[model samples]
Target: MQNKNIIITGTSRGIGYEMALQFANAGYNVLAISRKTPQILIEHENITCLPIDISDENQLQQVNEFISKTLKKVDVLIHNAGSLLHKNFTEITTQEFQNIYKVNVFAVAELTKICIPFMEKGSHVVTISSMGGIQGSMKFAGLSAYSSSKGAVITLSELLAEEYKENGIAFNVLALGSVNTEMLQEAFPGYEAPLSAKEMADYIYNFALTGNKYYNGKVLQVSSTTP
Candidate 1:
């Protein structure tokens, strides 16, 4: 599996970080990107850490160059980096909204665009969204910006699945439930999640490897409860 290259973003911690460890242990060359290098991932021989803030245009360009030079082909691309602004809908500033979208949607799109040339047939793109973004779910207050950005990710993945089907590339979205992560703690203080980061990482890793064979243009909500 050393020949297989997987790029995972927001790997400084949480689900993304756990996914990097799982992929590295499975012998895949893991390209881990985040705003800062996580201490655990730095010592892995199969993991390459890129300290990149995806919201920054300049840093994103650097990521494009670095990955292009380092890997000949991309087998899987996981867009897990995200931003959440817990504020009332009326209080969200334009810049804050943009920042949230930058990481949750725009960065995913830009990075995927750059990585597509390196992705051959059978490559899979898995985007991480949130249950809050899906329609018909119980909506919550103070999540307007974050939820909307995730909603865009769902549609974007669907569109990409159609546009790139000819190339044998598949796109899918995982509308994740609340997981035990720093992001979750920050967004919902003192709340406990049924799913741990490692558990979610395990599920995502397996899906990333073989999900295209079973699914395409699908938004699968993964939650323990119907919040």
Candidate 2:
């Protein structure tokens, strides 16, 4: 893991923040991207924080420029950024749904495309998804847009894995259960989650490092509780 380079999105806080810290602490060069620059990460010697809206095409080009000048290759790319819309299907507008999909699904695909040229055979692309995205696992009300967007990404990962298999690049999704995140609090008020952000980040950290060796084009349900 020494001198390895990793690019992670959604690092303003929660699991994404922890991932940036974990990877940088392990001597890996970390490029942490978020809408707002993460204060804690900017001071780290191994971390370079980029503030950009992943959903915006113009801002996404900045990621390409950064990589072109900064790193030789990308060893790991984790699409940890997500957008959640907690609204009833009846109340959801087309624009509202598009916003969620833009962040969750479209951004993942576009960003992966940008990073592909930098990725080699052993590189891994880990996308963070929701358990609610799984077809038969369980369903929740007021998550039509959010859950559906997550589901789209799951399938996207599967196809990317197959398409990139010949290149030796791996694509996988982690469908997570309830976690005590700011986004979760907004959707389910006062609902205590069994897992903490740091704990989940710990699991994902190890998984991103080694899961690709055993699994590719697979969705691992990292949930111990029902939503």
Candidate 3:
């Protein structure tokens, strides 16, 4: 997939950063977006780093305009930016739920809407969901908001895949398990490492590059049964 133009959100660190590196290594032109620009991205010849909050509509519009001018086509779009709120149900305020929805669900949908004009048939859109979006784990108190937000992402991917089927666009969700990222560290503090970010990125990159049409609208889980 040399010379494929890709747009990825949440690239300041963690899974997003890994994805940017992996895609760039594969010779894809990558547009990496995050609230803050990372130094490593500055060194990548095929990567353009955009520092903008995904949740802001005006900024998203600006990003859309910039991408339209810079790239002829968007072959891939990966939505990876999200927030986690680890608080009990009762402790979560209305604002907290709204904030989670804003970042996790709304931003993804809105960005996809804006980017669709720049995409065409053979374009792939992947959302970074979680196993938490698939099945509820035991005693995972304080994760209701996070889980629910991810569930929305899964549904969004499915609906987008269905809606764009005639256009030859593919949409899928990567429902990941415990990846050894800062998000996981915060969720399971002091826990042993699970999977390396590069390994996870490799898996996701391969999936996005080679997945068949039938894989569209499916949530593919990536994780080992044992850490």
Candidate 4:
């Protein structure tokens, strides 16, 4: 059987890196995109590491060109690249907020827009969100910017689901809880998470492979609730 093609962002480290490896191991052709393509991902014969900053217009165009000319079809898109700025509500500047949105929200929109032409009937798009984005959940200080961006992501996915239904495309957001990743460490120093990056990657990979069968336009919260 021919391998399916998947495009993943933030492949330099953490969940994105692990997902790329796991997807490749699962016999998928993975196009790993990052600002800096990690050497490890490049070494994987099934993975093609593309160095493109999603927030940069020129670089994003390069990705569009590559996908148009090279890939005939894309099966899945995992949007994992994001920016989290820990700051009090008052301290968060407009530019800072926009920067986070650039990677977390706008980048996803732009890439998915360009890739729509290449996606077939069964294509799935998943964006990695956070518990902070979940409405009615406990709000944390110094996370207003990040949380806001994630909220946008959830809503965007929902809207995309409606808009792309005619194309048989599925859009979902994984509102993940704290995972043991570099991003988590930077946000909350010394805090331990119930799940590791590899574990999260495994779940995400499986979901991307088969999630559309059950749900679309949903924000699936992934986390351990035990206190």
lDDT score for candidate 3 against the true structure:
0.86
Off by over 4 Å in 3: 135-139, 212-214
Q: What's the lDDT for all of these models?
A: 0.92, 0.93, 0.86, 0.90
Clashes of each: 0, 0, 0, 0
List TM-score per model, in order. 0.98, 0.98, 0.94, 0.97
Q: Per-residue lDDT for 175-204 in model 3, tens only?
A: 888778887788779876668877888888
Better of 3 and 4 by lDDT: 4
| Alpha carbon deviation, residue 94, candidate 2 (Å) | 1.1
lDDT of 4 by residue, 1-227 (tens): 24799999999999999999998887788999998888878888889888888988678888777777777788999999989888888988999988998999899999998888898889999999998899987778999989989999999999999999999999999998889999889988999998999999999999999999888999998978521
* Best-matching candidate per lDDT: 2
Better by TM-score, candidate 3 or 1: 1
* TM-score attained by model 4: 0.97
- Estimate the TM-score for candidate 2: 0.98
- Where is model 1 more than 4 Å wrong at Cα? none
Runs in model 4 lying further than 4 Å from the true structure = none
lDDT of 3 at 136: 51
